[model samples]
Target chain A: MAAMTHTETDGKQGLLPAIPAGLRAAAPVTILLVLGFLAPLLTVAAYAFATPRSFDVFRSFTLANFSAIFDPSNTVWMSFAWSLAYASATVVLLAAIAYPIAYGLNRMFGKWSGLVGVLFVFPLFVSENVRLYGWVLFFIKNGVLDGGLKWLGFSGGPEVLYTPGIILFGMIYVYLPFMLFPMSLGIAMIPRDLVDAARDLGASRFMIWREVELPLAMPGILIGMLLTFVLGAGAIAEAKILGGQSVIPIAQDIEVAFTYAQNWPLGSALALLLVAIVSGLALYVLSKLDLDRILGKR
Target chain B: MMKISRRNMMQMMGAAAFAGPLASATRAFAAREKELNILCWEGYNSAEVLDPFRSSQGARVKAESLTNDPTMINRLRAGETRIWDLINVNNPWARKVMAPAGLIKPLPRAEFEPYFDTMLPEFKAPYRWAMSDDGKDLLGMAQRFGPYSFVVNTDKISKATAEEQGWDLFNDASLAGKYGVQESDDWNVFNIFLVAGINPFKEHTEEEFKAFAETAEKIFKGAKMVGDMASLNQALVSGEIDLYMTGGTYSVSPARADGYPNLRAITPLKGPIDGKGGISWIEITSTVNNPELSPLAIEFLKYVQDPEVSHTVAFAEGTFNPVSQMGDPKCFELFTKEELEAIQWDTLEEDMARSAEYDILPDYDKALELMTAAKRLRG
Candidate 1:
């Protein structure tokens, strides 16, 4: 009878404290983030400190990999510089190219906007390498452009494939949609009455765009720029398939270290450095933006 | 409706419970005895090569192809030895790497030695790469070899000039921006050493290293493009490039077979390594050191030695190559005129004579770093 009374008292107190509903709801995504994102990142971090050229991650720790990268004799820094330069150029070029198309989608497409949007996204379903190779077939000597031109009594197509310029061109072509959609959403977010109000208040076309439209659409534009820059910085295929390795991006260097060199520590260090740069830039931009407002939260 | 007794229903359930595991165990035992798994380079995994063997042996055969030899070797190192029954890679790995690592088991000498006698003369009995370094064990079987050097359009740079000029052709200032470089790191390093008049196989002094670096930088900077075999071949066909470095009959055979006979892989008449200017890669297929070693492994090895299978392997996957079995008259007769021309059969012997066997370089890592640095500096 005493033992039964003790069990009753414990039951009344509850075996465990109740979990908050919000925490319960977030359990799945939180677990996913920990397992998928955090675990791999931690593994990479552990590898970065491993002995150079060795797979002794966690068992051994040394700064040798970082030292090798920091060594003055290493020209891997040039690859990093090239990758960053290309990424920056890609962002600027895509901004220029996607803006007009994005504007037309918002202001002109009407109810057909979704269909036009699908056309832009259609190429994404095809493999990136296949589409790039199609470009290769089109641009290559005696290829479609050259053959067609020659048949029409023209000299031939200009030599454009397999150059640094073409690498940039390929990146812009590939990342255009990443820039375009976000920018379209940003432009669409602007209230039409505000621009009209600015115009009625005796503002010039440029002034209205500057004071009302640009600031309002800045969030989407910022997201687009961030997306393109991050993706461009990690670009590898464009340099290989299109540029003909005219330039070795940092990603290729990291790949070589992992594969041909069999230096997992060095590869991890290189990857970590790239991640730091891209993540630092991303976090800085993301911190400044009102994500709640951008995402349509009340 | 008639009602069944509970006891009868209980008996049926008890019998099913007892027999289910027995059936599964029997199936598993049968599957284990008949299963053969292969890890190899691309050609050996093709349906043309595997399907007939599967049907003949009544076995369940599976294969995975990887492009890089080191990557496949590393997979074995990472505990995949238990999963694979057979492994086929370039020749040196068997003698130089895999044998030392114990990733593969030696074949029976009496059974496998006769196959070598039927192979090309270069792969005659006691072939160095197909044996242990101590010459006590038969390591593997050799097939699919060619002299890899550089290729050119015979129309622009005649084959004679290419052979005569050799590595010096790349040094000529006029050829800058005219030739493409295949992005094969190992072959590129070999070619760069040849260009620098250095033997890549030997350990190099600091001065030789400096020379290698300079040659690498110059080669990368001078080339019109650096790309894969398909891209380089396309560029060659399109007239965008006159020649490409690190090519062979293996890389150019498809184009040649497509009626572009002017495109030819050139083996230089002279080189730094004992006067051989070209590197040839021979593949060796060996039994993996799996705990459950399949009996079918040796049977399939012998099966591929047959003339029709050899011909099928040579032409598998759209890339044409000459197999060592072609040295046998029976295998030679299997080739059609077009196929013979495709593999550049006319020059195979002479090219092989002029080429050094591909081997592991003592300073490969250093050379790769220098090569990678040169590539980056070019960027």
Candidate 2:
């Protein structure tokens, strides 16, 4: 009877195709992605198509939200433009600022690099809002900088708070670490031997850097840019806390629609558009890269 | 050790999973009887306010605070009515939205009406906002209320000039870049309308909207800064801005409490809204129409009406404001001289009298869009 049971089990196992080991390993993460990420996105998409200002998600469908957003009279698009512009600015400025710092950490810091890295990361322990408020206190009239200047027998510090320039400054300040760490990793990945070999071949420092270092570091640099850009695009706190809502970012507009306006469909539509733009850019950039090589799998 | 087959193990796991939810359901059902859930604005949810009620009732009391009235009301509209036993929001929502939609239960008139007797004269029995539109049902209890308008550093812009100039302060081209605007959307919209010489509550013509759009643009353009209360107060203290629109007692009280008494909230002496130049907000705490409403909800309603609780609610969350019960000597005496000064108790009566009740704007969405556009344009 045991032999017969074993024979039946073998028959059943043979009839059912074997699952791929990779698929079996991926099951948990795939399920998590479906439940956690895809479900909320699908809900947002469904709501994006619902009636304007109505919570008839999944039950109704309309393009009124899209129409309103696209309408020339509607200036909501300016918010999106401002967000992308700020994000672009943040990426550019952070790239310039972080590249030098990242280089110094990798090339100049020696064994103290880890401690220096920790120093760079320390500010993140405090809430971004608190730190920005600290900046507010520093720059505010009769605040630290201004008061110090006054004590030193000078006019108070410049009115730097609540300007468009300060919004960009705050984004650059808040997202500096995001740009720095990835960039440091990228710079570290550049083999010292390759640089030495190029020097031995009489390659000038600039030539070696431009030809070898930049290309090799592209992956990490791109990752940092993407990270900072995405973060900056979605930034609301810097604008609120530091920029003083001088610029209404798209996120705040979306928030207002959902909160004060109680128009979920409109908010969802705005959110979906932002997600599409960001994810589209991300996908395009990701598609051009060899992630396995970047991740050291090769 | 006992050996179990793989099949038996799977069966046992499945049974546990099925039983887990059933046990949780049983526990949740049991908890409902001993739980009182409240949804309110910030002050009512403060530990200082809720801890006493929790101990007195010997029940689990939880409260959530949302800054926006429409957002909180929308939670009920989204079926959170089943979750909350009490909902406190600005006055109009109870009469204009919640009671009409049956999201909130009307209070027992005989039991709740007398609480108003001790309240401020403005909130006297048959208080319009606390009652249903038909004036038959008492929908909620009035509590924290104050005139909300622009605030100024009295040292930079004297209170007398500010009150007299009123909303025209924002319109003055010479004062451009000298003042700031707070990021309170509804209040900004109202102030923008007032600056444009249009009544915000009434329906408007396209021409009026055009004027509103222009005024919003000008205001955003002229502002030295735009921020929340704290930032505005800081700016005011530092002289970064002489004054800011969309501020009042609720926004300036903390600064006043901190000894920067020069940061004063000014209600304009006269302008639109039936010649009342300021907008005042009165919070109405009502019973939510939950399927299994806790009896403790009514007890809490009565408890907060007590002078001591009323005083606590007024000063809760670090932002000082006046309560309707201050008309009662017991409640009035609870406030110290400093506290009274912080809340600008001296001007409270006159300001309220000169202020129009904050109301639902007929064209708020359009105004919000225009305002948002103007802010972006400034950026």
Candidate 3:
């Protein structure tokens, strides 16, 4: 009952708590974000416009970058579409798998929520690469997954991580906690009377869940989902370590340009395109749910 | 009192900071036992010249295989000690970036002198760019050379006159859309210039770059896919691609071993683009800048070049035979005449003799720009 009240106790005080820093708070991070991610991007954008031999790097402007990006004969766009599809698949599958785990934690472990959360949180301690390597072992031909399935008479050899399925599993493993924590918090905070009221009114289990539990859990669900989607869309490491050339992602392609490919302006252009994609998503999520307001100080 | 004030003023102006800080960080490189580690590629683990030291010397060797450049650089940059005793790297990374980062140490002459002849001149060039101005400071050594050339799966192309027929394999009408080219190397982009018979260095205009791009656009017409050396090799073996462009067709022995009896190499008379082939500067550096391990590291360097070790690795790993053949006639018995040619960097040097040179490996900024552009183009 106390926790239920806590959920509705003003949308402020989560991430956007106000007291001292005010405008200067975001100033530091905003400046950092702009300088760190955007500054390089802006430089790249400038170069993308410059011709190969142009003297004035900043003022150079042309559409060759755009033309190069859109050369239909090339495989660039096809790869973008492929990554988008893969990321999308990752999100849908992750959400479905995570919701149950979130529910189990919220309902069964209210007495030990903090401890259980910590236990669930242990995977974060190791490096992302180590975790990806773990997935690699699990996915190899005679790895744990195949061996386990074979014992059960499933008879599958080439398992998930070696193929497209491995890439998806990596995405899910990384983002599952992103979904679970928030959804669990929301489920835990849902008013007990709501469930009881639906039962008393002779509502079916599906109806009670759909009309009652879901709409109220929407805030946590939306926040979790938005985060997971953004992470899925932005991931590069998981794909590179586990997917190889079999599953090329946009993030990996952007990385290869600066490192092995050594083309900065084009790397920048791809980066901007990625920003446009993620930002468009952020805006949509912001409009649909009063997330910032809910998250902001009351 | 007046003189004292003058002296004090002089001291203030000539403060200790005026004495330049250590040229780098104050950390010491002391000899420590069994504490450091190494990261490298699969070919880098050859046993003949290098691997014997691991057991006989009573030292622990933890070598990891990684081909991609970014991951290796990132791992080194992440500030972990006890990571590696050696990190073998390629140009222009060894010179342009990693050395500046102080992640590696300077190579000593004592360690380098014995194995010096085994290293070719191209092998010695990176040391200048990487270790010192003349590259004679001995900061690193070259283990293998991969020059740019083309390989054809004879099962696919079936050319009876390959050595004479040349690069028409790229534009052959029947092979259109059915062939493969490396998506790496901006130099390969200039291969289009070669097929069109243009010298890229003759005050090459944008027309040349575009002509190459257009040629590329045409060759790519109806193409099923594009990828790197690994992909091209896979395609050749799996019958997916008919022709492969690589650092060199030196893999002819192994390709032949794969039972493609008709496999052959065709380095064009006009030369393919600029030479992308050169040396890698993967020298082992110690955090302990000591007399013991330093000489031992050098000894290991010399010991590995002993023809026996080079022969063992060249056969096992399909990387080149790094030993100087004239120096060791006995090593000749280990490989066939054709196999010996397959491991020789001199063979490819003949092909690269007429071509212009572009340092595809440059400083970080240029490195990023070229690869980024290629990725953008590949995309």
Residue range with the least summed lDDT across 10 consecutive positions in model 3 chain A: A48-57
CAPRI grade of model 2: medium
Candidate 2 interface RMSD after superposing interface residues:
1.3
Q: By TM-score, who's the top model here?
A: 2
Residues B1-379, model 1: lDDT tens digits: 8677896688789899999999998996667678899998888899999999999889999999977677788788868998898999888999999999999999999999998888888889999988999999998988888889999999999999999999999999999999999977878888999999999999999999999999999999998899888889899988889999999998999999999999998999998999889888898999998887888898989999998999999999857899989879999898999999988999999998999988888888999999999988666
**Tens digit per residue, CA lDDT, model 3, A1-298:** 6466678654555556664557756798878877898676677667666653232347667766557777765456655776777667876887788777787787776678778778778898998878876765565545677667878899765634424566777788887788888878667767889899999999999998899888777778877887887888878666555653345577766766555554545666677777788879878977898664345332
lDDT of 1 by residue, A114-142 (tens): 89999999999999998898899999989
Colliding pairs, model 2: none
Model 3 stretches with alpha carbons more than 4 Å out: A1-209, A216-224, A235-250, A261-298, B1-28, B32-42, B45-51, B54-143, B159-165, B190-192, B200-203, B219-222, B247-266, B269-297, B312-327, B335-379
- lDDT of every model, 2 decimals: 0.91, 0.90, 0.57
Give the per-residue lDDT of model 2 (tens digit) for B1-379.
8789997798799899999999999998888877899998888889999898888777899999887788888899988999999999887889988987999999999999998998888889999998899989999999999899899999888989999999999989999998988877878898999998888989989999999999999999999888888888889888888999888899999999999998999999998888889999999999999998888889899999999999999999858889999989999999999999999999999999999999888778888878878877887
In angstroms, give how far residue B196 of model 2 lies from its true place.
Answer: 1.8
RMSD of each: 4.3, 2.8, 12.4
lDDT of 2 by residue, A15-125 (tens): 765866588679999999889978998999999999998888889989999999999988888889999999999999999999999999999989998899999899999
Q: C-alpha displacement of A85 in model 2, angstroms?
A: 1.6
Top of the candidates by lDDT: 1
DockQ of 3: 0.12
